[model samples]
Target: MLLLIVMVNSCYVPSNLRTVVFSSVNNNVCKRLDGDIVLYAIFVDSKFTNPWSKYDIETTLDSIRVATEWIEQKALEDSVDVHIQVAYHKTLQGRVPIKNDFSKKTLSGTLYKKPLWSGVRDIYKWADKIAKEAGLSMPRDTSPITNIKNDLKNRERLIARLRDHYQTDHVALMYFINNYYSDEISATFDISNDNNVEFSIVSFKNPSVIAHEFLHLFGAYDLYLTQYDVKKRDKKKKDKLMEMFPNEVMAFAHRNLSSLNISDFTKYLIGWKKEMPVEYQRLLLKKGYFTAKY
Candidate 1:
């Protein structure tokens, strides 16, 4: 079981916050890779260092357009209907510093030690901060995530508002941070609730990276070797997966989108395919996940 500790008036490490895993992809708001997906982009910039410019925002929008078009094209090739629509909400200034590559401690201390739940909490906390700063009244949801049933009623209400505003059920909250010089890792947070809380914090405006993170919001796992893959067997599997699909978007995400294509494995993950082949079962998630209709 995942232990979620909510500390008050302090930045202390949760004593035992390890043993976290990716929520079932279908549990994310961006459930399927089909139909319409509204990318609710929230642009944030650090006041101390990098700041957002009109040109930067425009370029990032252009990149998002290109990335979405690429994803749509890939979906078409797989005979899946997918239409991406981006909705830029607002540029938040003066308060934006969502930085944490947890090493020995967590955002409060270490990434490795805290893992998914801590990261998820950070995301929620950041979103709450953004909402509060925007003068939106929030209901109390101070409880930590304890079960598959989300305790964060504030998040639910916020998401409902966004959905109603956009007139779409599928909304992927994207936070684009202006931290290009810091070498910060862009992140697609684990699914909090299939109906609402699904988001990615992107640092760069690269089309491929943007598209890769978007796909992750749906279901695609990282095909390339990441620091998260600490197990030797997992590393070997990732290496093999990368070798199998060199130009796969989930594999070489840093590469240009023009050079990359979504693989069958990725297709399955994103719901473009009905089923993942048994041959690649090792790479697919555990049992009870193959059955899906989100």
Candidate 2:
């Protein structure tokens, strides 16, 4: 199992040196700037999702592959030694998600709810059930484990199955939910493992949306302020992304994938850059910012 040991203390890091490591780093699955970061997508169906077909699966997979190519090309121009590997498995059945006035009356009773996760734990547990039965590489089932003996085992098994299949520790698991009639929100939750896998829930098959959410899992932050913004400080950075970098993928996912590219600000968050440029510091943070060492 891969062990992430994080330690933090005040230290002066050299600005331009790629070798200068962080005193404090995020303990998440999508770490490291270089090498292969597996993008293992789990194709799942739901009441709100379109039924999967052989053609839909192939086309969707092709879109995801194209997105990976965009990221790899951007990393190359920026000199970040990284490549994205794609793999996937389709679920045997459709799963339910916890939503207000939807499945709430049933699943909302005891299911965990958090703003960050948006209660995706329910979705993951249900989907893993199918993948596990399919004999595919999936994360360990950590649902309702009351047995004390299995607590530690469940924790270490963390991403055991996925790690085994990829034969590499750096893997970013994603769930691609096919679109039906209504559009669903796409998000990436970084719940740094509490016997769970930190993954992304993608509702649309658009290459831009796929690539944008994938980058979020690795550590990139949304530059454009959205309707989800509630904090006053968050609103302060409103539309700064659009004004500064109109072609940034994180800012506008609706744009053509060829027109969008990753900015230096995103490069730093995903561990591709050593430090943030002084000129672009105010775009996201006001009280200044510390480099989020991954």
Candidate 3:
């Protein structure tokens, strides 16, 4: 059983950090210059209808290390000096099944939307219970997303538990399960607030996918446009990504590090660069995201 602790301060906003709220719980938690960031990575052995075994996780450990190393190397390249520590949590099982089957309603073409934050919250709660069973205390400080009334108490409880259990600035979850079509997602909560708990979930142990999703927690946006974007994205146009970002990891996960580099736009979002580049700002504006002069 997970004990719920109420944090007096619903959100903790750092004075030097600025957050942009995409939704109630999803916020861009950007790092300040030279700030030390600790990412607690957990490998979750989930027991869905088609579950992932301990053996599967064991095999994937090497790939997970590769993914984290990529993150550290990228940060170093930009002089961010991020130190990411990957920790393994006890295996979690017998929770609500994450349906692999997708219907048209659950997805808008290639973009998936079935298991929203609500579903993710359920898994988080289960994981919290497991962590507590293993003797971890929930932190008393947590920040709630502004204007989001749905499941606010539960959200607060999970965040508090994660902050205390991980004892780190950030948390990332690698949910290893049976192979599926759509694999990775970054879950960001309390984007514009302090003490935000951000995490990423990967269905499989693909290093490229892990790195891409991990960056999302640190305020990186998807360079590839989905159906949700106002402009129709052509999946067939491989050249579109190469032309725009060349070797950018966020856009071209298949490319090796030698061929890939962090883009200025991503650097700005993740707090490596204080201000957005003029060209990037124009791109965002053209994409229908309003930019207020800072």
Better of 1 and 2 by lDDT: 1
The TM-score, computed over Cα atoms with residue i paired to residue i, of candidate 1 is 0.73
lDDT of 1 by residue, 1-294 (tens): 111121112111222343122343445577777787788676765443256777887888999999999989988887788888887654254432233232322222322235656655656666655543332432333336533422233545556566655667787777786654444566766543444465676767888888988887786777877766789988988888989898998888777789999887778767777656655654544443333322
Judging by TM-score against the true structure, name the best candidate.
1
Superposition error at 77 for model 2 (Å): 0.8
TM-score of each: 0.73, 0.72, 0.61
How many Å off is the CA of 171 in candidate 2? 1.0
User: CA lDDT of each candidate?
Assistant: 0.63, 0.59, 0.47
**lDDT computed for candidate 1:** 0.63
Candidate achieving higher lDDT, 1 or 3: 1
lDDT of 2 by residue, 134-181 (tens): 333244445464443222122124345556557777777676666553
Model 2 bad stretches (over 4 Å): 1-26, 90-121, 127-131, 134-158, 191-196, 284-294
Where is model 3 more than 4 Å wrong at Cα? 1-35, 42-50, 91-162, 165-167, 182-197, 230-242, 255-258, 286-294
Per-residue error at 274 for model 3, in Å?
A: 1.4
**Global local distance difference test of model 2:** 0.59
The alpha-carbon root-mean-square deviation between model 3 and the true structure, to one decimal in Å, is 9.7
Error of 2 at 218 (Å): 0.4
